[model samples]
Target: MNNNIKRTLTTTILAAAFTVQAGENNFDQAYNSVSEADLRSHVKTLASDEFEGRQPTTIGEEKTLDYLTRQFTALGYQPGNNGSFLQPVELVRIEADPNVTLQIGDDSFEYKQNMVIGTSREQESVSLKDSELVFVGYGVNAPEYGWNDYAGVDVKGKTAVILVNDPGFANPDSGKFQGKTMTYYGRWTYKYEEASRQGAAGALIIHETAPASYGWSVVANSWSGPQYHLVTANGNKDRVAVEGWLSVEAAQTVFQKAGLDFEKLKEQAKNGPTAKAMSVKASVTVKSSLKRSKSNNFIATLPGSKAPDEHIIYTGHWDHLGKDPSKKGDNIYNGAHDNATGTASLISMAKAFASLKQRPARSVSFLIVTAEEQGLLGSKYYAEHPVYPLNKTVANLNLDAMNILGRTKDVAVVGFGKSELETYLTKAAKRQGRIITQEDRPEAGYYYRSDHFSFAKKGVPALYAEGGAESADEESAKYRKKMKVILNGCYHQVCDEYRDSWDFGGIIEDTQMFFEVGYDLANSDDWPKWNKTSEFQRPE
Candidate 1:
């Protein structure tokens, strides 16, 4: 063997020997190191008024990254990005003129009222004038599931009006499309991506509060702010020229104008093979102005002893809505649950790993990203421009809006059956005298709403687990009702600040659970893979 090959082989052998020598699992010590006090301290700082809501491309980002880097350094972690803790992500922010309106034949859709639209493409100017519109049902084309909403339609150079969520959602059938649970196909991101793949000039997802989960106000607020997209080499030429959402009422108006029954078509769309494409006899117009900026993805590494080349990643987005100046009173969206809690968990997890007596066989990385509130952009960038080969990545465990509802009898694994990581989570939770359950409200599409998805799309097994229904000491019904109130009242609003009433016990439990899962993956020879039937499974 050549000198370099000999050196690599010797190192691997030596590391394996070291792993064998370290018989006792030091994970308990590490898990114990993940303390509630530490987690709360970190979250308090991250979500404080001083951090200015941790928004990307602002002083808030600077403060957040500095805090993360400092904490990782204190935990004895090395810079993950080639000796640098920060990964530079180029992005373009587009602020659409609020006055922009969409004319669908005689029916007009007003911005932020009837509809919301923006383009992912990075251009000085973008416009679509009198583009032909086609109702393409769910807009999904999943061959594995034997479903295709755009099968008979040619949507190229025209606008495709699609429905949010999967067809199985509105009308459930166990025989088709994962039943009521939202698949990756149900995500709004998928709708846009599938539209782009079909060569559509534009895509508009018709939003219903039930199917879409969140209220119309969510779509309005999320899409209204400065929209962000990764800076593309071809200036996002691959993406649709226009991408957006239309209110249910507005969508019904378009269908009525086209001499079609919106309700009847929706039912048809849910039934397999009955869904057909129809010309809406309508058109749309949109224009946007672009702004460009740079964001940083803070990456820190705890190198392994045996297989340093392989990795188990812990990821969380650090960005939120920032400060809205228009609001008269408190305008800072602290995002204490939306993700400050999740971001802080990264530090606690890092501390736990660093406290270990012996490092795991594989490395662990803390990927604290930005622009999650702006459509998971930072994680998307990291997935595209990874510091390590994606094939070498064993798994990603993501935390978002951590459990503030106290300890629970079970942990909910979002996208539960997608990977073997869920099995590992179940084992860990079982040790804590807790069971594992799939997300109760699968219709919300929680799996696709977080950062782990960015890695999952690239074939890395990712875990997104949370405290499930039935808090240990509270009645399940009362617990769920209160949780719903929080989700409705505080989520993405200025009110998502750190509160004294919030329980960190469940957060602590879940954080340690994540630590244990990562520890198992990093040390074991087993490489977790997506389920055989999973769309995210690696091509063999």
Candidate 2:
């Protein structure tokens, strides 16, 4: 081998040997070294009244990005994007018309209670003039599964109303669908995109608090305010004419009036194929207002010694609800658990990675993405416009929220079986004398909710690491019950704030574990591939 080739080979083999020994390092000591007090200090500061909840396109954005940039610099990480830490993700913000109305043959859809609607188009007003409507089952067009909800249908200029959740539930015992695991078919975004592909003028997904696993209020609270989308030419024209959700009750009423059985269709949609799409034998119309705005994504990197071209990434979002001074007691949606915790912990991780005695073989990029609360906009932009190639990029370790119920004896990964990342995670946890927990509610579609989904969609293996289901010193039964109750209650509410008495012990455990997941990947040559069953994994 030439000297250069021989040198590269030497480095690769040395990295392999070092990783074997590094894997056995004291993971618990690393976990303990992460200061919970320091982490909470950052969280408290970001979620504090001074930052005004860190909303995008406001002074809060300035403060949030400034603090994050300072943290990464203090941690000794080099700037990630061309010697700068911030990647400006241009977005068009849309605020719905309070007087918005959807009418289908004299029947007006209820706002807030029935459905939430908005447009990303750059127009003062938008309307759907005499477009027909159809029910396209779950609205999924996955070819690998031999399923097409749009079979035998010309939905162009027509609205396709799809059912929510996975087809597995449609035919419970048929073994066609995933039974309980919510496939990508269940996501609302999928319904809209499928409709767009079908050239549909509009797409409406039926939402139930149960199958959706979150209350209608969660949908309302998120959609009521501002919605952000990547700024693209043709005004994101490839997207559907419009996208919205209908409440379960509203959908039942409309389906019944149209001589269709809402319950039966829902069940049928869950099964393989519904054969025919819901016929638009009816017409519908809607009118709305739109807004344009801008946001920013914060980024930093721990440079590698040998392979700077290859990368490993750690991601979190910095934006939240901002100051909703309209509410009483606490008008600010501080987003303590929603993401401030995740962002703060990332700051901790960047520091830990920077402090290592040895530089990694691959570059470690620490990214604080923007507008995740608005629907993973910033990370989506980064994936589309990455500083590094997605293929050479080994893995993405994404954090949004960390459980603050103190330290647990276990760690929970949302999509545990979907990729080889889990094996490395299991090893890391075992090294810390902790265990890994699979998703507690796989049927609810937790895996597809965060910014990680964007990376997953791009065929880059990613992990959504969070607290384990089991609590320390608590009985399994009590832990399960308590866990379920808490997730349901505080999922997306004003109540998701900083708590003084929180035992950040669990947060530290998870952060340290997350640190190693990236550390090991950054130091090694092998890249984790998606599992065989995972739909996102591209064919060989």
* Steric overlap count per candidate: 0, 9
lDDT of 1 by residue, 21-57 (tens): 3347575677788887898898899899999988788
lDDT of 1 at 112: 84
- TM-score: model 2 vs. ground truth: 0.89
Candidate with the greatest TM-score versus the true structure = 1
Q: Give the C-alpha miss distance for residue 540 in model 1, angstroms.
A: 3.7
Off by over 4 Å in 2: 1-20, 23-31, 275-291, 325-329, 475-488, 538-540
Candidate 1: worst 10 consecutive residues by lDDT?
14-23
Q: What is the C-alpha lDDT of each candidate?
A: 0.83, 0.76
| Residues 365-387, model 2: lDDT tens digits | 88888888877888899999998
After aligning candidate 1 to the native by TM-score, how far in Å is the CA of 284 from where it should be? 5.5
After superposing all C-alphas onto the true structure, candidate 1 shows an RMSD in angstroms of: 6.3
Candidate of highest lDDT: 1
